[model samples]
Target: EKEKKEKKERKEITPEEIMKPYGVSVDNIDDDEVRVLTKENLYDTLLSLAAPVRQLRLDNSEKEDRESGRRVVIGMVGYPNVGKSSTINVLYGSKKVAVAATPGKTKHFQTLFIGEDIFLCDCPGLVFPSFISTKADMICNGLLPIDQMRDHRPPISLVCQRVSRESLEHVYNIAIPKPAPHLPPDTIPSPDDLLNSYARARGHMSVQGRPDESRAARIILKDFVNGKILSVVPPPILMNGLDAHGLQKLTKDFNLIGTKPAPIEDQDKEKKRKNRLLNQQRGQRQYTDEDEMDRMVRLDSVGHHQGGKRGGKNFVQNKNSNKPWLEMKRAQKAQKRAKKKR
Candidate 1:
């Protein structure tokens, strides 16, 4: 009865209540509602959002100044490295604004005219203060740059806790040492073990011939940020059989159409096949006029010239198809026969 009551209580707790301790307000979260949009469809989504502004401009077109009324200004502001410049570049269909993985790349406000009447204002990214539980959490969330991090162990430890040792090994192609038998079976591998193994595998050694953990840590953190580790936090409200937006379907499709290249064995087989064909062509004898005449004489000797057929089947000529050389040879043979009769 106690277990059942605890399960009921846990089920009754809302996502907002769960996040309240983390200083995150779910109700105050207001960003783009559309989670996914392809580049081809971005224009349509932007047009839908701009419909109201376009209508307002049309309604006040007569009273407002001609220049001001025709133009539409949209300002983009968000946290650092949250794709503000990338979004503008996508809308413009070219790389107008500079974008980088590190934050604070856009240091000042800039204006760009994407369309005839639409002006996009890109403001510098701002970092807002929040009640963070630990510095590791901030680093894991990519709020701190990995290259500038003084201590990388804490954030790497957080990653080790979230991602399994097998997954890390597969990604980095290095084996991490397992914990001692005296420790609990559930104990995860330490950041030191992963960093040491990864550093050794990548040949990142220090001056003293020790594994360079700092360099390995930067590489691992970059992979984590770029989604190579494949970590994601699903929304609390998400439920099975209730994906109205078909995001789950799209994800499955993307997985089916993987971006990875073919296996090494397959690539090697293709190269070998190409080389074999090239060698075979090089080894074979080349075609010449003498070879063509010898082939025609051999065919006539074999009684293949009767009715322009070979073994009672229509003879197909070479790729040139004109057969003018064969006709000239036949004329010279007829002239030699007439001179012998004279």
Candidate 2:
């Protein structure tokens, strides 16, 4: 009876009875710093996973003279006509690079060595999903200058449609309404004839009548010239591929259109700017510091910054799209939950 009663009492133990022995042990599990279930892990778990890897990030050092690494050598890579040359031209404050209304104007890896140590490398515009996947190969011949792309760019297949002799002939028909230069002046048909001919060739048939040639021409031109119909932009890694350093250095000090930066310039510049501002402000406390006086003084003193929109980006900037997309890769690795350093 004693043994049976002892067994029954042990079986009837409550929830608290089983857990109290290991309570402190379970809460503070750490064997040689291999941790488990710490309170810090409960929050910011996703942030720990999503944050960028920073350990091997190259320590960007600045050199003022003609030293080895004074500037950030950035190569603008994107689809043809995505504003590669225009960007380079504006960056160095000169039209050293070519800007045209046609596609594929820049054909060289034109390196403009701007200011001491700062070199602006203007590469040819690359076309994506074309001959290959690497940026170097597409740009090997020259940069493909495409139209200014806002959104989805048109497909090359559509570009093929617009490259026909008939479309050019049609535009000449409606706009000029006369014989084409390529064709004889006397033999050239009326604009309506050319439109009808184009429509018949493309097989545009209306429900009540023959094919609508004018509408067909408009549709073809829309796809070729306008991006509303398609959204294909170029890739950087063309058929040529990236070099070892080009591949490695893309981690921290990297950017392009379609990306954002943390902001640059030294803490000293910030301090000096603030001091100059404070001095100007203190001087202006009295009516003697007239608006015209301050303006004239600044016009002579600093020159440009206090003025309107000087050196600020006036247009939308373009950048590489693949880098951010590649951040979440797993074989790539993850990091320990960042300890909020005291």
Best lDDT among the predictions, by candidate number = 1
TM-score of each prediction: 0.53, 0.27
lDDT, candidate 2, equals 0.42
Number of clashing residue pairs, candidate 1: 0
User: Which residue pairs show backbone clashes in model 1?
Assistant: none
> What is each predicted model's overall lDDT from 0 to 1?
0.68, 0.42
Give the alpha carbon lDDT tens digit for every residue of 226-293 in model 2.
43222222133221454433322221112121122222335465446445554544555544535544
**Residue 150 error, candidate 2, Å:** 27
TM-score of 1: 0.53
What TM-score does model 2 achieve against the real structure? 0.27
lDDT at residue 35 of model 2 (Cα atoms): 46
User: Stretches of candidate 2 above 4 Å error?
Assistant: 1-66, 130-219, 222-224, 227-342
